[model samples]
Target: MTAHSRDTPQFYLTAPSPCPYLKGQFERKVFTHLVGENAAHLNDLLTHGGFRRSQTIAYRPACESCRACVSVRVRVDDFVWTKAFRRNRAINADLVGADVGANPTSEQYSLFRAYLDHRHSDGGMADMTVLDYASMVEDSHVRTRLTEYRRRGPDTAINGRGAGPLHAVALVDRLSDGLSLVYSFYDPEQRDRGLGTHVILDHVQRAKALGLPYLYLGYWVSGSNKMDYKRRFRPQEHLSPIGWTLLND
Candidate 1:
């Protein structure tokens, strides 16, 4: 049921399911639909409250005894590039991200499918079809964009956005407070290059360019090895009941 403004978010606990991040652990979530004209504003407030958006729904982990999921945001302007981070920047130097229309493409689907198969075979999205992927990208009611990542094509200068093969893609939401990384995936075979962290670093620069203070990296599950890299983005803020608290370096 819908509630009025100023009402605390109605929390719904999900039935037990296999945890996608930590094996042997069960997972649950508290969620609500993010519709209506206030969708964007609601998204901002919920984000600040440690909830993340997926299409029209916003959710936060509400597992019975798990405190693994923690909300994370990077201080874009103050982010100091480390030696490893700098090396990654040089490695994918030719890669450029272009914010394009939220429409899905066959190439994007192919990459997405491969990423799911290789990286998340047992996850919730293992069986998502092209139609589902399209809906995920285009079914948003807030400010959203698809940041297509590609190796700089020859005429990238003229086109502004590259026009060739897509190596990776991120569905992101642009908010008044910061850039939310809704979802992202890359070629799993390129794991050697650390494409995942590169995308986040790239978005931090993008956030800085837009004069936004933070890059909302979404939830970081403490027990999830895949999410541990989030800690590398120095000078970040993690939401706490007290307030947006600074994380220790």
Candidate 2:
């Protein structure tokens, strides 16, 4: 009999399912559990290899017929600040994000529920209950944090914390090279504010401030309208057969 070390990751494959991003296409994934002491290091390596962390599992697309999912990471040092991105920043100038522990709350759950209901009602996570949402935020083996965005308060400048109602939330992982955005949700009613784009922009600044070289944005599926916004963050790297290739266009 042979014993496997808890830190030794073993890969598994999921049964094919309907692709969420594209119509009439099936999707499959190869995954490994990130557990024990080496989880964070393993996560960083796998992320560089194009895997995404969901809970304690790191997975990447392995569809037999499609190769549209491309891993993308923004080059924090050379990030482009376009007119639209500047406008988005200005629009969210009154808001601030405070890093909090990866613990789920009723308030966060309410906003998450509303976001799913309004933005992705037909998606896979639409039926997620509070317990499921809690697991999503807290069931992680590596270093993770939750950034809660809210309107600026009087003490924001002094304390660097926000106040009032929650506007958005970002679940992020701290990797060796960069920050990987696991999930994010925002108030759907505040569409004009472009909270989604604002969140990404904020993460770019945060990563740069922390001296991290990249900000992993997960997989960008070509021809998926849901992923088109990712391309706007210029000077990004796309994982390819050879390695991480620069993508300026």
Candidate 3:
């Protein structure tokens, strides 16, 4: 088949599985593969249209009666830095990061373990092994990157970035239209640091720096408190029945 043919995403339905976000209700998905020369472009379109990426698969909610998963994207140019976000930046100012290859390391695994232990102890990803983590980072067909955060050392002016052990990281996908945050984790012990918010804030900056227009922030379930924070990024666009609509505060 030609790239043009692949351009039209062929959708498929996933078998029903236990819902991660809700209880009692089963969840299903309508998905397509991100592959070939059209993968990047197709991914951009799908993501913009409310799909989320999982490895090489791009999927969206296709439940018969449920429609809870809402795709969210931050407006890079108009994003407002709230007081809390500003404070997070100040707190994590000492932490620095280095964007390494997608290859995973023992250090990253250790940090991942710590993050899971503290925050998601009984969560789905808690049982992930080193190999599983490696695949999570490396098994991708599109443009992907790993920005590992660390503490700044002396002579910071020389590097213009930090130099220390890894404390946090974000798995990012570089798309033609925007930056998609595939997953992120940070040192959970430093709750005072507000690293979670800081990472999202930092990515907004990164997207602006890269001249990207949006930052894909997965799903935002309205009733889910865990997702309410995503709305804090001002001038964000949420996928609606009519397409992406800018949410003004």
Model 3 residue 10 lDDT score: 80
**TM-score winner between candidates 2 and 3:** 2
In angstroms, give how far residue 207 of model 3 lies from its true place. Answer: 0.7
- Cα-based lDDT for every prediction: 0.88, 0.95, 0.85
Which candidate's lDDT is highest?
2
Judged by whole-model lDDT over C-alpha atoms, candidate 1 comes out at 0.88
- Tens digits of lDDT, candidate 3, 1-249: 545565567889999887777777778999998877878778777887888888889999888767888899998898888788888899888877677868789988999999999888988899999999998888777888998887887865686556767778899999887899999998888878888888888889999999999999999976667778888888888889998898865
Off by over 4 Å in 1: 1-11
When 1 and 2 are scored with lDDT, the better candidate is: 2
Question: Which window of 10 residues has the lowest lDDT sum in candidate 2?
Answer: 240-249
> Which ranges of candidate 3 are over 4 A from the true structure?
1-9
Maximum-TM-score candidate: 2
Question: What is the clash count of model 3?
Answer: 1
Candidate order, TM-score descending: 2, 1, 3
Residue 19's lDDT within candidate 3 is 74
Candidate 2 Cα errors over 4 Å, as ranges? none
* Clashing residue pairs in candidate 2 (N, C-alpha, C atoms within 3 angstroms): none
Each candidate structure's TM-score, on Cα atoms with residue i matched to residue i, is 0.93, 0.98, 0.92
Worst 10 residues of 1 by lDDT: 2-11
Against the correct fold, how does model 2 do in TM-score? 0.98
